[model samples]
Target chain A: MTEVTQPALTIDALGKKCPIPIIMLAEQINHVPLNAVVSVLADDPAAYTDVPAWCRLKSHRHVGSYELPGGGWAIHVRRNY
Target chain B: MAYFDAASTEPLHPQAREALLAAIDVGWADPARLYNQARRAHLLLEQARTEVAEALGARPDEISFTSSGTQAVHLGVLGTLHGRRRAGRHLVTSAVEHSSVLHAAGVHERDGGTAETVGVSLTGRVDLDAFAAAVAGHDTALACLQTANHEVGTLQPVTEAAEICRRHGVPLLVDAAQTAGRMPIPPGWSVLTASAHKWGGPAGVGVLAVRKGTRFRSFLPEDERERRRVPGFENVPGIVAAAAALRAMTAEAAQECSRLSALVDRIRETVPKIVPDVEVIGEPVDRAPHIVTFSCLYVDGEALLTELDKAGFAVSSGSSCTASTLRPSHVLEAMGVLTHGNVRVSLPRGASAAEVDRFLAVLPGLVRRIRQDAGVE
Candidate 1:
């Protein structure tokens, strides 16, 4: 069995719309140390694809996404630089 | 206001208006009846059918008028599937097809038929190799592809796709709603669908053409009208006007195509430079001549459209904020492009260079203001 490492930070953007979640992610991703993972909790449907696409465009790594028990998704991203 | 939403619905052409008025006076009588008025109406309907067929490169008997483009798509997709039920219950379509085709595919799936959507490239072009692979099996009954993307204006390889479908003995349905009047329909499609309003004709008029020998059985309740493909009393005047508009637009397509291409090229090249963090989406070249889309970073799509409306420029967007479903555009999502703060500018026929320049001059300031308001600057 593989061990799951916890995220260094979690952004609770559950009620926010698109581009807001993306903006919040972009503003806060740099606060963590290099190679640290950040999880963004978003309910917007656009966030599902935009988060992964944003990672590609910014040269960051989108580790994975997980569905939350309450709702929405936890999109995990690793800061590469 | 300078209208930049032509891809949604073009303003009716002068020729269409003239034909509509003239035909409305004489086309009110039922064409199926046996009377002088009926004879006149029948003649007008046949003449319109011939005109539309000539413009679309099909025989008159092959063309049928439907209520709307969406309806045409449903009939084309479901009808072909029903006709080829013995062959298989499998369907193939591109990932970025219009909602009409996608919805039809959804219906197919709900009815126990299976569908496979081939992925597209970053430029919004369908992956031909993947498309070929999807239709290789004998179980694949039909494939649907658009002549050009409505949102991004990227052209699909319909000729090549049609060839692949032929090799597999599956019929191909080409949705030419965006290209019917602007460009010549490429050969090799077994069935074709288009909307009238996209080409300067009135709304509520749609064109569906099924090539000879293509197996198609209407899924709707059978009626003897429109070659038994479409039911109910036809919108005769609308069909006449649509045909007139198609002919006029086709005659001027070459000149207008070049003129609009230059304007769109200017927009594609200028948007990224003028606006900070702007991504101009879609193919840089080999696209429809009139459409150019771009996404502005850290801006709300609705706010930007409202601001542009105040600035006397009408535009459309694929952003999630603008959509009623609150979902981002499937086209953009499939292409993995930016989906927020998006703007799609499609120029209509006779749009002058001065109007384009004025639009270009004012766009940067609006984007900057939206970004500032969002606290992104």
Candidate 2:
């Protein structure tokens, strides 16, 4: 269950392996705090576990993480700002 | 004939063979049984645990036996992830961990947890900056890094990675599947696992050790065996043999490792020079001394492996043994190297130089044959 009605940025981090995706999204999320919403796209299976957990530790709201048709995920995240 | 697949499974050592035969009558009884035979079984089990623990520089109470090295990793990874679930759901591991650890990460995700993957460089090393950043965002539960890759023999900097994991207060699980029987993990690595078969020991015996005060609890259903970390009836004879073999292998390590290291280094440096357009995998400096891998362009790896076998060489193909998939070696792919004609020659202890010379003598001809068949110049 995700908390909707927050600022969003669709960060498509699909198919990126390891620290590459994590670093990209972290840099992207730093630009604008409140309205920054990242929808991460990833093909790496580990990202399914890594992303939401990243949300939990950062105090940002993990809105909803749903899979796309081509095997990537659309994880909507909002900056804690 | 020269055999170079010891990384997969070394043949049984004479010490292990003797121990296996001796233990058949004495250690076959269930350790849990109250009878005399059972007491003997229990004593053997204790001795095995002590020897293996000492080899890994671990306390006796910290070690638990599992059915296989794969099982040990499965239990160790799952236990660490579950135990630290409260810290955060993100688990961090390298890209080139064994299939067992990869699958365990899958199980972790199936339970609604997430995993942060660290990428390896073309040299088969994890990027430290990336590693530092992966754990920065989350209360990472555990970070799993193999000591040396089983296929390419690349050693991860577990010490540096462990330092980062410690900074995030995450427990590090080191799969010393290749190096545990040969090298020590030393001050780094919180949890360690190894297979007996990799070190000329009997198959079906694995050691999983967790350091004291670590937050690792098994995900397996509660059981009376192995302090509830691993649950199953013991393979007593295999355990006894594994213990005997491990001791023997490590005892000879000072001399044998240097001998094999020289052999492997000669192969690593000379193979590419002698055989044209062959790319060797794994870090030249930071890898196991027993394994050397290379890809011959334009040749089918399986065909090359078969050709080597026909030439009285029992080396291994890095290509996945899954015939149905028919894919090239994943290890080579991750290292960003050619995957077409990958051959992983893992020298066993006591392998002679004459056999190595014979194999090398016959290698370039086989490579040309396969390359010609594949229509590649």
Candidate 3:
């Protein structure tokens, strides 16, 4: 079995609304090294769907999302180039 | 101001206004009464029904007027589920149906019934294979699909869907509020519903048509009016106006459709090229002629709409920031498209090329300004 790697960077966009989370992700995802994971913590409902859609559109790998203990989601994305 | 929100409600047609005034003078009496005035009123009501029915390719007896389109949908959906209870309590619908259909499904689910929502594609068209599979289940009582999507304007394959429902002995409830006057109601719908205001008729008028031999038992408390299908007194004047508007619109549809189609095509082709990072939503070819939707990547929908409004353009959006629920439009989410910075421009009849060009010219700058305000550029 392969060992799990922690996210290299985590974006705390908890209280922000839609498009903000997506914009933050877009601006910051390039900062991470290739194939490294970036986790975005967003409570806005649009992020749940738009983040994955954005990943698909931008050609990045969408790692699985995990629900935070507090009422939000930690959406993980792995950079592809 | 340029009105680009015809899908929300079209401005009243001149024919509808004239008919409404004439009807108010003579159709004020109760149609159910035995007086001479009532008899005259009944004739007008029946005449309107026949006109509407002809437009829908249905018989006069199949048409019933409801107070609003939402009511028609409720009755069409719940009544069918109730009538076919012996068959099953399951409902099948696409994910992009108007809130009326989805809310009716919600009510059914709350009342101990099961529902399955089939998803759509990136172009906002329903997956026919998935829809066929969803309704192929033995317990599905009814399936619902729109003639065309209200927001994105993608026309569903109603004929094919109807064939599938027929094979399964399931009824199909079609919400044709978007296409009733603009285009022919696609054939094979077991029951159909439409709102008058969408067709340049006055508000408070709705059409509910159920084909003969379709079993629809009303769930609401019993009333003798509307063949015991819809309860309450009829809006005779409104119904008359709605019928007149429908007939007039139908006559103009072929010409208006092509004109508006070319305008919409221009918007669809130009929006993406003129505005950077914009994705035009909905099917490119199989969509309704009058509506086009698009989304910008970094701008907020409400801000863009407000700026456009300031610039004398009235449009609608499906962005989370614009919605009261703070959620993106279910239709956009279902299609997996960008939901922020959304705009749905549904052209009204007789919309000019100059107006469309002006809109196209102003939109890119508005989007850019909104993006800059949001610190995107």
Candidate 4:
């Protein structure tokens, strides 16, 4: 996989389950500058399906998910609004 | 593995299974037909009706079978509302009624009728004062309440609410889907509904009982079956199985209730003590014997259920956020309790004490692991 630009903000959602990870991303999305990428690290299986769905529902951009070296996933979303 | 979702549906009782198999050959013919075979089928159907009616303390003439408990509730709510339309169009029900009753009330509203939803308390019991006030309105045509709350297992004040409705001349429809066959239904309800599957009977059989004097107009397209209340050919075999199961369960209810109540008490006492940040929902003293519900902070109910299932325990979660439905449980929300990460453990008939102990022993660690996986501090 190719390396992407470092996110403007990193959310440590690892071990966090759904809605929590989604809620964290939502609450902190605006903390970063608009259009900046925010990375959420989470392992909860629900996060895989829910994060992207949340992005679509909230009209944010789900950049994509990447793997963390230690395991789990790094879900990327861009603050659009 | 412990099968602890009886509130959802019980495994078929042995009596039900035997009755179902035996009746299949005898009940296959149309009961409406006049041949000798049909005569036997008709007899079977009548016998099943009598069994169910006797179990429910209602006349066989008043009980009609529907496809499922949800169907029975729809028929009960809509039939009563339509029957009393001339009196007024207002319907009264609880905020935590099963989706069936709520959906029928929604239809009533869409059809230009009005409905008042009474709220429940933190313990998930209906507020009698609010209910009485709601039913007291002269324009209220019907009031619906459940014998027990399905999600949290808290018994409702059905008899008291029924008295208020009676005083107001409003018919009270009781959804006894969770309590029927497990206990004697309290008296005074004008109409009652229950699902066969909830009590170890076969699926596809639901009972709707309308007291003889209650005003209830059939809303289905004109039909001769089930007094035109529920239209379509009767499910004779399933009905036979359901009635047989009802008889068996009712016969053993006193003993089963005691056994299950003790198990539930153990769980009620143990879960909070062993698992931190867990809130046990439901009225401890006034709840159903076979069911208990609790919610965990900082954990996902769906994930927890998955872990439990993997560990060989089949249970259910009340959290709406757990699955496809993103909306939280209206029952929990109505009670003003935490809706996140809710687990409802309902013991089936014959659930063993050892199984309950095994589940209790494994639950705390599983919940802790799930919380850790969620990264909740």
lDDT of 4 by residue, B1-377 (tens): 78999999999999999999999988999999999999999999999999999999999999999999999999999998899889999998999999999999999999999998998888889889999988888798999999888999999988888888888888899999999999899899899999999999999999999999988898778889998899999999999999999999999999999999999999999998999877888999998889999977657888889989998999888676675775567787677665667899999999999999999999999988987776655
Q: A1-81, model 2: which lDDT tens digit per residue? A: 245554456666776643234445656777666856777787654455445645654567667778799887877778776
Ranking by lDDT: 1, 3, 4, 2
Among these predicted structures, which one has the highest TM-score?
3
With a 3 Å backbone cut-off (N, CA, C), the pairs that clash in candidate 4 are A15-B373, A15-B374, A15-B375, A16-B374
Report the Cα RMSD per candidate. Answer: 1.5, 11.7, 1.3, 9.2
In model 4, what is the error at residue A65, expressed in angstroms?
Answer: 33
Chain B TM-score, structure 2 = 0.96
Candidate 4 lDDT by residue in tens digits, A1-81:
443657999999887655597668766888999888999998765566456656654678888888888977998888898
Give the Cα error of residue A3 in candidate 4, in Å. 49
Candidate 1 chain B: 10-residue stretch with minimal lDDT: B368-377
Q: Give the TM-score of candidate 3.
A: 0.98
Query: What is the lDDT for B106 in model 4?
Result: 92
TM-score per candidate, chains pooled: 0.97, 0.81, 0.98, 0.84
lDDT by residue for model 1 (B195-262), tens: 99999999999999999999999988989999999998889999999999999999999999899999
Candidate 4 regions exceeding 4 Å error are A1-81
User: Of the candidates numbered 1 and 4, which has the greater lDDT value?
Assistant: 1
- What share of the reference contacts survives in each candidate? 0.69, 0.00, 0.61, 0.03
